[model samples]
Target: MNANLKGAAMMVAAMAGFAVEDMLLKSAARDVPVGLILMIFGALGTVWFAALAKSRGDRLLNRDLLHPVVGAKSLAEIVGRLFFVLALALAPLSTVSALLQATPLVVVAGAALFFGERVGWRRWSAIAIGFAGVLIVLRPGVDLGWGSVAALLGMLGFALRDLATRGAPKSLSNMVLGVYGFLALVPAGAIMLAVTGGAGVPPAAALGLIATASVVGTGAYYALTSAMRLGEVAVVTPFRYTRLVFALILAALVFGERPDLLTLLGSAVIVGSGVYTLLRSRRETQTAAAQEI
Candidate 1:
């Protein structure tokens, strides 16, 4: 198969995995507090990544740990993840997912500012239009609350993390990166737990709920990785838009969220812009590749 076609397929699968992961967590969130959910999700992720490292014989302590900036990036990811859970708890699933479209814009700005990547006017314009679409969906009034704010910050923080990752030392293995990300959550979760008191007593049913959420999350990660391993990276990357479809269905089923006309219009704009971003990125990459040869 063409590598691009393979990558496209894998990316679609990865997007589905992420959507499933979100659905699972959101399902559990109705019954559990945000802090406990974060901890369970984090712990599950840590254990999964750790076991994979062991099975693959990935070294624990390499001299080339992440750069200081990279460490900061990992911390940003922790913050982003926490806010993501908070967002799910606070906003409509589709709305929250739509807000997440801001991440690519943030990443573009971060790349230009932090890495000194030359930002052409065209990409910047696309990003600006994309963010305008986000604002339309959010329509933040006085009642939007801290949850929305947290989700936005999370998106921006994740973008910063990606920028930091680009500068990361090549010596750091993916296993190390995964470990850093998961372990970073521990302290944050502890703090949140201290403040919130750990999701009350887990009812008999809560255990099953939390467990189910964690398992789905782990599976999502596995599916995502497998997709990348099997498919080409650039082509597969655009399939991530499927998360919105999944989130919308889950929101309606789980929380009875139904979108009015404005939401649909905004979503169309965001989706178009996101797909454009992917197409543009792939073009640039191919151009660079051709130049190198």
Candidate 2:
């Protein structure tokens, strides 16, 4: 397969990892502090990503992960992961997944600001309507709650994380970047553990399941970044909706959580809008490439 297709495949795998990780975290949240669970995920991320780097022949001996730009990107990711975990912990998986559907919009805005990328009227329109879909999912003022707030903040934070990762040096692989991201979280996790009266060990079975989730997540980060880079950000992003399908199914199976009609309808709108944006972006990228040729 071509490199780009390989990247998309990796990204799809990453999304699957993300789905499983979210499920595990949501479940573990019931028995453990949110802080502790996230911290554990970070720890797992650090070790697994570092190993991936070494195995891939990416050196891990850099004084820093290649300047402040990469460092900033990794740190942003740490913050994003923390917020995402808390969001999932406190809210329904379907809702958090749906809220995260807003990510493509965030990416478009970030590209315009950071990379001097241009946004045509078409993309801008899709973004606006896509956010409207988010509002539909949120229906914020009507059903105001902490989970909504957490999901919103988490969405924004992850957006930043994604943006920062874009400018990282080509020398560093995703594995290296992921390693630093998790390492950045270590101190933060330790601090939280202290604040939470030390880690409260949950059932061994739960802990094991969570550990597996963390491992998949560590690998998934690389897949996701690869996907974003391989395809047009706008185009490849709609594939993220696949997570919602997994989440909804798991939510029903694991939690017996049934979403109401409004939720499903809103999610459909949000996802459909996102898919349109992705297709447009992909077409645009192709047109741009053809022009260059």
Candidate 3:
């Protein structure tokens, strides 16, 4: 298969994996505390990534994990995963997933502010429109509840993680970064569990669900990493939006939750703006490269 096709396939598979993980975690959340779910989920992920790192002859504990950029990345990872999982447990899967799609827009805006990237007025307008889509979904005057807040926080954390990752040192392998990312989840989960009156005993069925979430979530991470590495950025990046499709399907079939028209409209706007931003960024890069040549 062509690399682009393979990458698109991988990206789709990753989105599917993540959708399954969310479904499982949401199921488990019926009985287990969100924090305990995260603890087990993170533990499994940490072990999985650590083993992979060892297989590649990478050191498990390295100074790279402590680098300022890496530290910021790890912190963002914890916040992202922790709150996202919480949102899954508390919010309608479809709504939270729809809101989560705004991460790339957040990243674009953050890059412009923090990295001094030159975002043209049009892309800035897209970002503004994308955020307006988010507001439409959120409906500020209405009491949308904590789930919306959690989802928004999760998006911000993820955007921060992506931005920091862009500046991370090349010396750290993806596997090493994965290990640190999962490792941060452990303490975050632990703290959450403590504040939530300790971890309650989960039913055996919930334990099974948590285990499934862990495996599928880890697979999603690796699949996403592979997609970005293998495919052209523009070709592969749009596939990330497909997660919303998979999420909506699972939400309807598994949870019997149907999103309203407004949510659908909001999601379409966010996706449209995000894709435009990516294509425009890619065009600018190509133009710059041509001039340099």
Candidate 4:
């Protein structure tokens, strides 16, 4: 397959993996503290990725790890994962996942601002409409809560991480990046656990769930990093919308979550805006190419 196609496929797989990981983490949270789950989950993923790197004869301690972009990505990862896990634990799955759908919109806008990528008025309008959808999902005065706020912050953090990922050193392997990504979760979880002051021996079932989530999450992280590197960000990013579908289905089936009309409508709006942004980006790219030709 072509690079864009491969990237799109990898993105879809990553979204599916992430959906499953969220489900598992949410399930485990019922039995274990959210902070504890994050710590264990991050530690397991870190070990797995570190081992993968070692087996491949790749150095885990590359100087590129100290790159400013990598540091920024690491901090973003911590913020994203920390708050997202909290949202999953405290909020309805459907709501948290719906808010998460706004990530690409944030990333597109961030690209324009931070990387000096050109974003025309049309794409800018789409971004505005997309964030308006976020407000629809939030329904500010009606149902705004800490969970909703956490989900929004988490989405922003993840968006920033994606933007930083685009500038990460090419010398670093995906596995190596995965190691650092998961490693960041360690301190994130520890900080939360320390503040919340709850760490206990999780039940065996919770341990099993956390372990499975770590493995799935590790794979998802790999796929995500690979997808970002494989093709144009705009081409691969729309597939991220698929996560909402997966999350909605899983939420309904597993958690008995039936999202309200506003939530569904807001999700549709967000997805529509995101798709439009992608089409606009592709059209611009094609026009630029044809002009060059």
Candidate 5:
């Protein structure tokens, strides 16, 4: 298979793995506290990523890990993981996943605002439409809930994380970055556990679920990294949307979730806007390259 095909396959596989991880975590959350689930999952992921980094001869304690950009990334990771897991446990999986589809759109707007990247009016309009879709999903005056708010905050946190990642040092390997990302979950979980007082001895079934989720989540991250490396980014990145498809399916099968029509419509709008933005960006990049030539 060609690079793009392989990358697309990897991306799909990664999405499937992530959907499964989310399912498992949600299941475990029934028996285990959300904070405890995060602690165990984060601990396992930290070990897994650290081992991968060691195998690659990457230093786990590099000074670059202390860089301001990395600090920002860590903060964002904490917020993202904490709220996202909360949403998974509290909300319908389909709705949380659908809201997550807005993350890349947020990242695009952030890039233009913070990185000084020039975004044309068309892309900005797409971003606006994407956010409107979020409101549709939220339906502010009608039926907004804490679950929806948590998912929205989680999406914003993740977008900020992606933005901070852009400023991270090139010297940090993906594995090392993964280590820090997972490591941040420890404090995030601890803080929440303290506030909620949900700490308890998790049952064997919960342990099993958490372990399986950690393994699947780690593998998904690796596959995502490989996909990005293996293909033209513009070609591979759009496949990230497949996660929502997988999540929707899993939500129906595992949780018996039946998303409302507005949720579906909003998800469609978010995905369409994101795709348009990506394609527009690709076109502009090509135009710039042609001009340079």
Candidate 6:
């Protein structure tokens, strides 16, 4: 199969796995502490990735993983995972997922600022409008609260994580990055657990849920990395939107959430703007390539 198609399929599967992971964690939140859930997920993911790396004869802990840029990436990951998990526990899953669609827009702005990438006025305008869409979803001054703010913070954290990933040394394999990403979660979970102590021996069911989420989340990470590496990024990246579809379905079926019209409109705007930004960036790359040719 062609690379784009392969990547698209991988992206879809990866998103499905992620959706399942979120659903499982959300369900377990009823009986398990969010911090404990994160702790278990992080520990299991670290072990999974570490073992996979070792099997390939890669170092379990590379000094390069602690490089400044990677350290920043780890910090972003901690923030992103911690807030996103908390948002899941406290907010509507579909709404939180929709808000996360703004990450690409945030990433675009972040790149221009931190990475010295030149973004044209048009893209900047789009980013502005995209954030406006986020505000619409948030409905500040009307339905505004900590949950909405937490979701936005989670989006920005994820945006920072992605932006930092751009500066990661190419010598480090995806497996190595994966291991470190999960490893950072160890400290993140501990900090959260310290603040929100609900620690106890989890029941068998909670343990099972945690194990299932860890395995599925680990697989999703691998699949996402594979998809990005294997296909044209523009093709694969758009498929990330499928996560919203999966999330909305799960929310409706599992949580009985029927998003209001404004929420749906806001989601549409976020997706449209993000896709436009990515496609425009891809066009710029192509134009630059042709000039080089």
Model 5, 1-293: lDDT tens per residue?
99999999999999999999989988988888778877888899999999989998999989898899999998998888888888988899999999999999999899999999889999999999999999999999798988889999999999999999998999998799889998988878888899889788899988998999999998998899999989988899889999999999999999999999999999999999999999899889899899999
Task: Write candidate 3's Cα lDDT for 147-257 as tens digits.
Answer: 888989998999999899888887777888888888788888889899996576778999999888888887898899899989999899899999999999999999999
Candidates in order, TM-scores: namely 0.89, 0.88, 0.96, 0.91, 0.97, 0.95
Which of the predicted structures, 1 or 4, would earn the higher TM-score when compared with the native? 4
Best-to-worst order by lDDT is 5, 4, 3, 6, 2, 1
- Candidate lDDT scores, in order, read 0.73, 0.78, 0.88, 0.89, 0.91, 0.87
Global CA lDDT computed for model 4: 0.89
Instruction: Put down candidate 2 lDDT per residue, 1-293, tens digits, no spaces.
Output: 77566666766778888888888888888787767776777788788888878888989877556687877776677667667777877788888888888887888778988898877888888888888878888887797567877887878877887787778777777678777887777777677678776476678877887798877777677678778778756545666778888889888888788887877877887788778877877788789999999
| Ten contiguous residues with the weakest lDDT in model 6 | 58-67
Q: Would you list the rank order by TM-score, best first?
A: 5, 3, 6, 4, 1, 2
Candidate 1: where are CA atoms >4 Å away? 1-5, 198-200
lDDT of 6: 0.87
lDDT of 3: 0.88
11-130 per-residue lDDT for model 6 (tens digits): 999999999998888888778887887788888988998887887788766678768999898889888888888888888998899999999999999999998998988788888888
- Please tell me which model should have the higher TM-score, number 4 or number 5: 5
lDDT of 4 by residue, 1-293 (tens): 99999999999999999999999999998878777877898899889999888877888998889999999998998889888988988899999999998888898899989889889999999999999999999999999999899899999999998898888999887678878988888877888888988777899998999999988877887798789889788789788889999999999999999999999999999999989998898888889889998
Clashes in model 4: which pairs? none
Count of residue pairs whose backbone atoms collide, per candidate: 5, 1, 0, 0, 0, 0
**Residue 135 CA displacement from its true place in model 4, Å:** 0.5
Model 5 TM-score (2 dp): 0.97
| Residue pairs of candidate 3 with colliding backbone atoms | none
Error of 2 at 162 (Å): 1.1
The regions of model 4 sitting more than 4 angstroms off are 1-10, 54-58, 223-236
